[model samples]
Target chain A: MARSQSQTVSLADVADAAGVSAQTVSRVVRGSDSVRPETRDKVRAAMDDLGYRPSFAGRSLKAGRYSSIGLVMLNITDTGNMLRLEGITSAAAAEDHAITLMEMAPGETLSLTEASRRMSALPVDGMIFNLNRMVPDFREFKPLPGLDTVIITMLEHPTCSTVDNDQMGCSEMIVSHLLEHGHANVHFISGPELSISGAQREEGYYEALASRGIPAPEVLRGDWTADSGYEAGARLAADPTCTAIYASNDAMAYGVAVAMHDAGKRIPEDVSLVGVDDSLGLFVPHNGLTTVRFDNRQVGLWAFRKVTGTHDMPRGRQHVLIPGTLVKRGTVAAPPSR
Target chain B: MARSQSQTVSLADVADAAGVSAQTVSRVVRGSDSVRPETRDKVRAAMDDLGYRPSFAGRSLKAGRYSSIGLVMLNITDTGNMLRLEGITSAAAAEDHAITLMEMAPGETLSLTEASRRMSALPVDGMIFNLNRMVPDFREFKPLPGLDTVIITMLEHPTCSTVDNDQMGCSEMIVSHLLEHGHANVHFISGPELSISGAQREEGYYEALASRGIPAPEVLRGDWTADSGYEAGARLAADPTCTAIYASNDAMAYGVAVAMHDAGKRIPEDVSLVGVDDSLGLFVPHNGLTTVRFDNRQVGLWAFRKVTGTHDMPRGRQHVLIPGTLVKRGTVAAPPSR
Candidate 1:
């Protein structure tokens, strides 16, 4: 590759232009609190004038660290995963780190050996796994002996940092809200069978029902897709006893909403609906589906911090839980009188 | 920084295990088409058994190409951008390439000087810019002097390859559909004021109206968001004469749909609606809004090929336009009785 070598400016050049020492320039670039505002401004001005871009390549070489992170993600056409990617990217940029992405197709698992091989090949200081399904044996894949690794999952790997939303709490909130809306029976629409989050959410649903002394209803399984939700909705819509339903995610909620519409049933009128993740608001502002808002961005951000050793967390394998908030939209209402 | 060397397996081990020469093992690892299937299978089996991973660091040293590409994208919370990223990632993986992402904050521009500096620093052999808005003077930034570069946009720049969906053609097909559905004037809900796609869409809207001898309605501006769409939809709902609306993208269209629903105006019954991009189907499954579908994945794939120098083209500032298809659903209809 014939790269342009014309605009390369060193820290010394910026320091010379700003009438400061190279150490002072480095301190300013590093955003040290000790640097006076006047000196910082001067350094910035000099950088702007000379178009000095701090090269991570040179810095990493000196520091003996790659200053790069690897994100291993499952291949899915989910907007949620993308949002997380955006979060990780932005956070990495803020910390002056780069990302090397390794994506695998759905159902294709990166074996322990494969991950180990990739870790040695990639010149990254840390790794984050943005997987849809929780890997039970993730702890076994110790790619680098002391490499900081973070996993975005519900299950807590005993030897790896975990960043995840409080799935059980989110599920409880949705179910509790539906019960408060005067719905006698709140049927549950769960995610995939083996999904750790799905299992946690179902447990939360049971806990909500158990606390209220209401018997747990049968759970409907969905693959976290609108089509699956639609299929479940069709089945539930046909059952007259099914009034309020709580879906695992917003995509499935949209599917349920569609199936109800196709069945000539009005939302919140015939069957009140609630879903986890307010992403529905982004995609279907018109649906007004009541949902729980969990920021996947926060999950991504925390994962980045864990891998980069920035967060003031415990040294051992840690689990960071992001709380979910209830976003009351138009979808939930008091159940219709029989 | 402590890396484990215990699990490292050399190529000689795999060659010895497979009863093949080290050169034959290398050819199989490189995915050379010349290697016999039976020999390739034997080497692959040996690799799987021994857990031998080929290090790109060593391979690239001999190949003289870093099998990595940089994707510079605008930082925004758009699902469409994520979808395009997924496309690019999957395509890159197929070709055994890694992606280094460089995301600038929303409303922040990657200046010519900054891009040039980053290009020289990044270890990528090529780069792809996945930008939302058309850069007015994109030609000014020539980052890599001789490295392959691809831009996903409608605007043509000399000395760079451009891959994009035909914005005007997509808009025209949508507008013509509304006009054919008996809409006297097709009102356009335009994107941001400075958007290149917005400008192109608005032009296509005007062209459709002009061809039918009907004056184009005043354009309603949006920031490519649902809230902006909702505001425009609210304003249009107040006007009894406004029958058909063409939103530049699906998010805005969703916002418009919500506003119409809130105002008790039935979609396609009181006012017809059409939007670009079938992403509306994901969020507003029940609304069933008519839209145009453009394969952004194809754009990502082609961009990757252009950067890797795999595409067979006559070089020099190529413009590859992806075609769009009209997806007619429930939202579009003839204008209400006068």
Candidate 2:
């Protein structure tokens, strides 16, 4: 009754008012079934009288579980990243857990020690690393002492679970499709160097061409943006011999399409184009962009499950790669006669 | 040294091992400068020996500050929502705070009581409601007892700070621009009925038309997706008198464009088209879409600041509206002579 307006009422205050022990008050707060109905009612009334608000931190500290998952993303602006987030969030919600989103500053790369330190300070039971950047060495990257971690990367860690789309296979499928269309040589618009998926995709591009006895053209690097794709496309458009192109992602492919249009080149008629991630469908109605369709949301969902230890792989660390399907739209065609 | 692998090492164990008080060990774990260097080092060494990991929950319980901000979004898949998320995350990173993201399941509506209950249970100091749903009555929608709240909605509450784009102004700007293009009538594609921004934009459309002494056409309803826009566009395309069209958002406009193209009507030749949110720039290159451009990121940044009580308006609750600029592309032109 003598409490100041700014002062926070604690469990002790409610206990004192209810004539109950602090443990009993805590049990009531946690909604434990052990407490008698009368005692629970008394504590609830006292809590209302004291205007006591329960603290999740206090509850978590006692239970040793935060009921929250830490999501470390490199960036959220990317469509792929957003889709993954949607999947992760949906999974988390289904499991009655909250997602703590932590994004690295635009170009910040975290060392293992730094990542460990940061993750240890979070009030979360587990962490999901949705950062697209490649981990240089899994041997050097040890998991945090007490935190469960799931990395969304191409590289598999000895002690951590990994979730990723079949980056290499996606590129291989695209390249094979282009080759089937009778293109003599296919140029690739690669993603950023720091990206593990990008590197794997480029490797697949090389393997596909090498297998077919066709030498791959020099890669045009794009930063997974429409602008970057446009610049790469402009250079490719000038080369009359460059008949087919596989952009690493859809946004860049869209940029390439625009660049081709500007240079008076028709899609498929003059040069064929294909991209990964069938995301352009949402933005462009009847876009006819031939792309590799993989569920990024499934990757997020799997990553969340792995982090929470709710996944089927209970014994050993597993690397789950969701496969991509090549969706043939109007972009691919046989190379034009010289 | 005798501890089992399953047993957690508490502050008491560290204190006993270091021959110090539990409070001293706690101070060391919290990195408090109040502890002596030698004692701190001893406690830390004991913690290392016992494999003790500092619990953020314990720290938050003692400090009564979670150092987190809860972000409640209606959905995360929308382009507008994604942009806002980018802004909020960037701002949170700058402020050294993590974001707890909680999204309502698709088509799920939250009553004020339910919203308050959820907010009260989160381990966060404040909350940012990025839910775009309209609050039927602000009087009935009370802020959670002890949490700081900032809502992203058109309606303002007495106790809560609000952040929004100039929704009404955006529609007015679009309508006036279409009128200036010498169009007798401009048809509108409205967003979902539950959307606060959508309702305001509809009001602005009516106001703009009424002031100009031009009768407005029947509103075509859309759910903010490209697919829905296509459905609405098909209906408008069949009507010969529907010369000018304005979509509430860009995705719908893109759908409308595709529909018009399918109907063998050239954009700005047979029917002029315009949209809100210049989001198509990132997806489509050479897409001459006349639109209103507003920074959803700014709305996010402002909302974070408001929730944190770090905004410019310190004395009273305020509604912060980020203005939209009318961006002219090639979508609008004089109507074709009948």
Q: Give one digit per residue, the lDDT tens place, for model 2 in A141-168.
A: 7666567788888777788888889988
DockQ of each: 0.31, 0.47
CAPRI-wise, candidate 2 is acceptable
DockQ of 1: 0.31
Question: Once model 2 is optimally superposed onto the true structure by TM-score, how far is the C-alpha of residue A119 displaced, in angstroms?
Answer: 2.6
Error of 2 at B328 (Å): 3.5
lDDT of 1 by residue, A1-338 (tens): 22234545789988998999999999998889999999999898987777676654456545556678888887546666777787898899888888888786665665643654565466577788876765545767654554578888887776778888898888788888888888997988999997777889899999989988999878899988898999999999999899999999888988998788888898878899988877754533354779888888888888888889875856778888888899888888899997
Native contacts retained by model 1, as a fraction?
A: 0.44
Clashing pairs in 2: none
Judge candidate 2 against the unseen true structure and give its global Cα lDDT, from 0 to 1. 0.83
